[model samples]
Target: MLETHGLTANYGQFRALFGVDITVAAGECVAIIGANGAGKSTLMRSIAGVIRNAAAMVVHRGEPIGALSSAEIMKRGIAMVPEGRRLFASLTVEENLLIGGQARKAPGPWSLDAVYQLFPVLRERRKSPGTALSGGQQQMVAIGRALMSNPELLLCDEISLGLAPVVIRDIYAALPKIREGGAAIVVVEQDIGKALAVADRVYCMMEGRVTLVSKAAEVTRRQIHAAYFGEAA
Candidate 1:
């Protein structure tokens, strides 16, 4: 339900994305995989409105929302779990999630209890400071906070960046439930296998360009290797 057409982004004079084109259909999960400096996060930010662009660059459903402020974007039903799991250090886990619900009161199935059910540990840690939780727990809070918004489209940037494998598996296990709620998801992940496992389609990028786009089940390791690093596999 989201599309990026000839999207480009810049930080001052340094360009981060170059005519990047991608699309996410309703209720589907899409993965973007690339190494550091590959602009995956930039693409996510551009769509999330952290980096603005031409009016037609980013579209949702059928509307052009390229220049909307982040708050406006959220109100329109897109919520982002930023790359760093940027939780409010002062707020408790429950309070942090409450902020998300307050931001966008859209009607959906993602309530506080629903989020807790998706990540049970979050309920147990509800009274703890958001940042005081373990890395994986913190990540759950970030995701829960975004879900609390009851968004139509969710942009998750690096949700598995630095967690243990078991924890990562637990985190990824929640994707199906999310999609079952009828929200499309765009995940920016470095773990190619993990991304492929959860996504229906995948985009591989390198040096600010999309090198390959294919169905997750059909894209081969060799293709991903070449697309990711610009080298023969």
Candidate 2:
């Protein structure tokens, strides 16, 4: 489980988040949704430890980890599939996946072969340069790379961004399996439908603050529109 309390972030002099608070229970899938610049990515980066915050801001299993380094965070059983799927262009798919396990090999159900099972095409393209793969395939590689760490908490930032609907569906389909494997997921996504469909709870953010938090299945479009855009749809 993870929690962020009064979490704030800044870009030089520009503040990006304002006292944001949220939580994810063990094995639950939580989604953060908002328009561009709504601080969704910022929130993810903060949680992933890419951007340092007050030591008490981000807590994992009741431990204060907001100020931990990204690598430290990874070693603590939290892995991030960053926005843009920053795969190594020079590394082969298998090599990229291997790099994930190199940091910390925490015991879990994810392995090279298990990841391949989650996304079968990855096994077929194991030796191909990561960038040589199609967008959807590349995304799969990104997810596979994170899973290779066998993290307890996985932070996915925009996994569906820029992919075709079918391709996005393929990627989203792996969420339940990942959950079944016992990892809690916090997905930062723009596709409202996909986010709500996969998440148990959804947080709608606007201008760097949380405007709505609801059970995903029960959320209405009008509420999301209002919370996301600050007005009625």
Candidate 3:
């Protein structure tokens, strides 16, 4: 469970997010969809504590964590698969995954074997350098790396970016298993169809604010189109 209230972030004088509010319940999957420069990633970074803000702005469960460091947030049961899938270039695939659990060693179902089960290809390429893998395999490694932490909340920023359609589908197919472990997920995605397919609810942002929040099954294409582009529709 996570909530953001009146959340705002700035890069010097230029503000990126303006009072963007959103919430994710335990085991719930929430997707954030927007065009480029819409602040979806900004909101993810803020929640992950990559961009510091007021202490009371972001809350995990019931405690404020806006000002906490990224490591602190990860320690508090939140792990992020960042937009670029920033895996360690020098580490082997298995080693990269090992680093994720090293930071916060908590007992859970996600272990090296569990991750390999989730992505069988990862098991085959366990000894390969992380950067040596294909984009899809690399993404799997990123997701697996995050899962190694056994987080209660998973922040996925652009998980589907730059992947082939079949690969994206393969990545999303792993979500049910992730949820089976009771981890709430926040997915920031540009692919509206994929986001809607995997999320229970969806939030659409424009500029720096949430313009629409609706159940994935209930929101229509016209509504999302309007919300995405700031159009009257």
Record all residue pairs in model 3 with backbone atoms less than 3 Å apart, i.e. clashing. none
What is the Å distance of residue 96 in model 2 from its true position?
0.2
lDDT-based ranking: 2, 1, 3
Give the Å error, residue 75, model 1.
Answer: 0.7
Residue 39 C-alpha lDDT in model 2: 98
For residue 100, give model 2's deviation from the true position in Å: 0.7
Candidate 2 has an lDDT of 0.94
User: What are the per-residue Cα lDDT tens digits for candidate 2 across 134-194?
Assistant: 9999999999999999998999999998999999989999999999999999999988999
Error of 1 at 24 (Å): 0.5
Positional deviation of residue 147's Cα in model 2 after best superposition, in angstroms: 0.3
Q: Candidate 1: worst 10 consecutive residues by lDDT? A: 224-233
Q: Give the TM-score comparing model 1 with the true structure, all chains together.
A: 0.98
Report lDDT per candidate. 0.94, 0.94, 0.93
- Pick by lDDT: 2 or 3, better one: 2
